[model samples]
Target: MNASTALLAAAEGGIIGDGRTGANLALGAGALGMAIGWLALARAGGGISTGNVRTGGMAAIAVGTVCTVLAVLHLATASGGPGTGNGLVGAIVAVPLGLGAVLLGRRALTRCRRADRPADRMTV
Candidate 1:
């Protein structure tokens, strides 16, 4: 299936178990993106030197985007209310988590760019 079709299926919880599955997936993606963004930020700040900050930042951005999209799609497709076992609450919660991850990733990317730039030289 195409990417959008797959994402729709995931949002509908058709790929696995019950209604909560999609929300759970979104939550996991958001958390992972946040972690990667944190690590990339640390690396940009010279706190570690094991991995490429740029790559980590890019990954964080991608994951965060996915999380947000999944959560939104779930929310759109979910039936009933928060207490109806439709995972409405979980999807709502995932939205902020995903947004936070995106912000963190963006910040890390900015820091990485600044760190990579060379010092300005005097012009004659």
Candidate 2:
């Protein structure tokens, strides 16, 4: 009703209202997406015989990237105070998770390489 009251409500509600719920959802979804991507990447690099790991790995990374981008976008664009809509939170969370995925993938590749090596058995 009153201008001051309306302004206060808006301030508490965020830019698009609902206290930036949309942003929160987007950011959360992004994190989950990144996780899925990491799994795919690792599986691809692992010594698995099925699912075409190479292609799956690439696709997973791509999907994860998209999710991260969306999270950053929402966190930055949404209007809120301090931690409410800050992109740093999402980014910080994503970095470590992403790194872990990379490590797993690298390990898988190493295993695959070692497996390809000739065995130490004698040629009886």
Candidate 3:
């Protein structure tokens, strides 16, 4: 698959694998889902303005990062609480989603930059 396709797939996989509705898991899952939706739309062929897609993807990345960090912090604190097991679950899910978001964001940025380059100068 192409880079865009691969990125979108990874993002979607992360989103689907994320389990929502449990302490930090909820936030992390939501963030991952948003990222997947945005990036997937961005990669789709001729469905929307590239600028809008880029903006949405960037926003998702930012939100996902914040959510991941917050989830991690929650997990760390819950180590002393009864919800430690839930926290562990969140951590397990969040790490992969967070890493995927970062990678997808980088890929989207790279694609945007490449798209902006003068077509005539593009090498085959």
**Poorly placed runs, candidate 2 (over 4 Å):** 1-38, 41-47, 83-124
Give model 1's TM-score versus the native structure: 0.93
Give the range of the ten consecutive residues with the poorest summed lDDT in model 1: 115-124
Best candidate, TM-score:
1
lDDT of 3 by residue, 63-124 (tens): 66755654555455343444534345655566667656655665666676677789898877
Candidate 1 local distance difference test against the native: 0.89
* Candidate 2 C-alpha RMSD relative to the actual structure: 10.5
Better of 1 and 2 by lDDT: 1
In angstroms, how far off is 15's CA in candidate 3? 26
Q: What is the number of residue pairs that collide in model 2?
A: 0
- Whole-model lDDT per candidate: 0.89, 0.48, 0.54
Give the higher-TM-score candidate: 2 or 3.
3
Task: Please give the lDDT score at residue 89 for candidate 3.
Answer: 60
- Model 3 segments more than 4 A misplaced: 1-22, 25-41, 44-51, 80-86
Error of 2 at 39 (Å): 3.7
TM-score of each: 0.93, 0.44, 0.58
Tens-place lDDT per residue, model 1, 1-124, is: 9999999999879999899999999989989988998898899899998998888988888999999999999999999999988788999998988888888888988888776677684232
Q: Taking the tens digit of each residue's C-alpha lDDT, what string does model 2 give over 16-48?
A: 556554334444545554555555555545534
Which regions of candidate 1 deviate over 4 angstroms?
Answer: 121-124
